[model samples]
Target: MSSQLLPRLAQEDESTDALSGPQTVTRQARPLRFITCGSVDDGKSTLIGRLLWDTKAVKEDQAATLRRDSTGQHNELGLPDFARLLDGLQAEREQGITIDVAYRYFATDRRSFIVADTPGHVQYTRNMATGASTADLAVLLVDARAGILEQTRRHATIAALMGIRQFVLAVNKIDLAHYDEAGFQAIAREFREIALSLGVRQITAIPVSALKGENIVLRGDDVMPWYSGPTLVETLEKATQRTGQSTGFRLPVQRVSRPGEGFRGYQGTVAGGSIKPGDSVVVLPSGVEANVKAIVTYDLVRNAAVSGDAITLVLDRPVDISRGDMIAAIDQRPQTGRAFTARLVALSPDGIVPGKRYWLKAGSRRQRVMVRPVSALDLATGNWDDAAVLALNGIGVVELDFEEDAIFDAYETNRETGAFILIDPDTLNTVAGGMIDSRRSRSGRFDALPDADRASITLPARLIEAFLKTEFARAHVGEIRVTRGEKE
Candidate 1:
């Protein structure tokens, strides 16, 4: 991709009277974006369909389509694609499953929502990861009878690992479990421990049967009398906690719009904190700073916009900028690096291991890289050890070397630009999605050590840190070589 074709930011402040136009400002709170994730056959689709149906989010025509598709021939089971109300894919209906993230927009009196119903099978783990990465909250579903399964823990762990703070454990199929209080409590207990261990801060456990509509939209008289919490709908409706923002402002110009009169517009979503007209901003990957002259949207060139608004920014100087480049406050700059090391889960059918080259897509940025799975920590022991390959449902850490500078924040910091997915070149299949924790040495000093030698080595922290730093610096300066270094 040519650097010139990327988006650019402008600098000026002459549009104070631009708001005098006809369009009225309907300023409202930004919608929250979230995702639903769980294993297959866990009633994920039913829960969402119920939510839309109960909330009247779906139109009559769409509901008719759902009904027609759900009526199978000869009264056989009709597996309609409930999620297709958003994306309407033929393959989704035929497979009766979600292959990709299907986004749906809905609003209540309280707040607006952009919900991504992600796939929930072992094979589509990457899709689930992608969905959960950007979500402020995760709605994790599970069968009441089949409580705390491996895949259940896996999904919960992924949600926590992705830095999602709020979790709603929708314990579906409670009717099948006879709405047993003991059963529900047992599952909730186990989930609470796992969630806490995985760093999940807030968890709300609800016992409801998605199929029977018990405790979903309304209270069920037949459900356990001891449980007195609000229904799923009510709980969600009452949730008013908004997500926090970055202390600094950063907006990556996705595209530039020129609306004539020699006015160049920088169009993109505000990815970081609030930005105002007088705020001094820097165009990154170029290291140029310019004061913000105007923030325009439709007929208004306003003073500021909170994060999540897709507004056009007009700066004080027309410097060279592009799509992959980021715009941020002059004093608060994001960290930059060419080589990165991250934890990745194998979403490929063949699994992820050493010498696997693929294309990585992070937000609007794409890069070619290779995933070398060095170690897999035993979940039971919490000890890292070498693995031949990380198969489906396996979690491991890998070293990634990008062909270009892939700008990103740590997953702990920002989920928007920090998460990415690997795509197979041959099939163009999204194989794995990952969150960058902390960058390791691209030289793979620790990864290259033999399994036997790694266990025995216990070098000083300073020596190990210096050696690793120098090794990676050399690799970044010249040829990409990750050969094993000196021992002892």
Candidate 2:
């Protein structure tokens, strides 16, 4: 509840050979962050409502209101309409579908959880992506009657692409299937194939009925005596949080704090690794190095702070540092380049256009960039095929050309430093979410640069740093030599 960032426990997500792997005595437990997703009418909102309801998170007043809302209507079980608990929007209530991401918090005696109930409609894929971006795990639901649909696979692909290794395939509405164990197993098996192919190893597929409140937090063993596996809550209780900060130190400076005279500090959340007083640090994009003078916070000055910790850092010497510059470990600086390969989730109705100039913001830095679609992923086949443009809800790989130097680590290596968003200049709305694949040299992407006339006119002679990174400069290294012209 303290607004400061977390010192999250690093727990390993152990993979097993089988998809329906065994749950063990929890090696670790802590407050977890996760999301629920899948195709439409998969009972995602109902599952979340069931989770909250079973955990006693719903107060008496809320329950009474829900009962009043369901006075005339009757479900198959004559129970409270669980979906209404989260589908608070008028449109959602009228249409009986979720349109936006609704977040809910609940806890068990064993651990706590923060669950984001993302929409299942294809148009709301961007909303789902926003929820999955920060989730450590994904709860992908499926209809026991329908098995795995195209959208189910799509949601799994997006979640895996966002680096969620732990997945729970909730085969919902089992009661509607007449409690058919064979049907549940069949659906669970197919989903495992998809999850494993995505490089996700830890998967727990459970049969559930959200409306009946079976197999969610409490056991449905009375009905499903064959399923000796743990309940959904049990699986979540022992599930591990992703250790996403394996890469070395990285800090994207948010702002320079000067609370009083003679006290200058850099404030930002530590994105990766750890930092301590006297640590050697480098201000990126400028390559100016300094040592840590101190680490300050509202709490007592600490000797060290790890990833996700929000604190102010005082450097040993005065340096040209500001918002949008990275303060990273001197020995482990992130890749700085003018071009990079990235995978993108096209989020807007207009889709992502080729050669369009948009604001590309990664971490604290925002700059003009030209994006070129290379290939889009076929969700059904999981193949990367040639693509000229990314349509809405399309997942594609593209190359990003930056107008200025950009710093990032591969998203597989560091999520915080490697992820970025594209903002349309005209509307100022986010159009896409991109994950860095690898930073490329300017020459690596022949078409990443704009037309020479437009480039030359738009960029001034003062943009010499970028000019030096151009293909011509690298290609004619011996002919084109750089010498510092003295200050005029």
Stretches > 4 Å off in candidate 1: 1-33, 57-114, 240-242, 255-266, 296-300, 311-318, 353-358, 368-370, 377-389, 402-406, 424-429, 439-488
Per-prediction TM-score:
0.73, 0.87
**Stretches of model 2 off by over 4 angstroms after superposition:** 1-30, 447-488
Compared to the true structure, candidate 1 yields what TM-score? 0.73
Q: Give the range of the ten consecutive residues with the poorest summed lDDT in model 2.
A: 1-10
lDDT of 2 by residue, 1-488 (tens): 11322333223433332233444433334468999999999999999998898899999999999999988886867788888889989999999899999988788776788899999999999889999999988999999999899899889999988999888889899998988999988887788888888899788888899888888988899899988776788877766677777678888999999889899999999999898898998898999999998999877788998888899999999998999999999888899988899999999899998888899998888999989898998887878899988999999999888878899999988999999999999999999999999977666464343343133233445776788787777775654435554653
Estimate every model's Cα lDDT from 0 to 1. Answer: 0.69, 0.85
Predicted candidate 1 versus true structure: per-residue lDDT over 313-431, tens digit per residue: 89787777766778887887766666676777776777774665688887666778866676775655445688756777677777777666667677676666667888888889877
lDDT for predicted candidate 1 compared with the true structure: 0.69
Best by TM-score: 2
Task: Single out the weakest 10-residue window by summed lDDT for candidate 1.
Answer: 1-10
**Which candidate should be chosen as best, given lDDT against the real structure?**
2
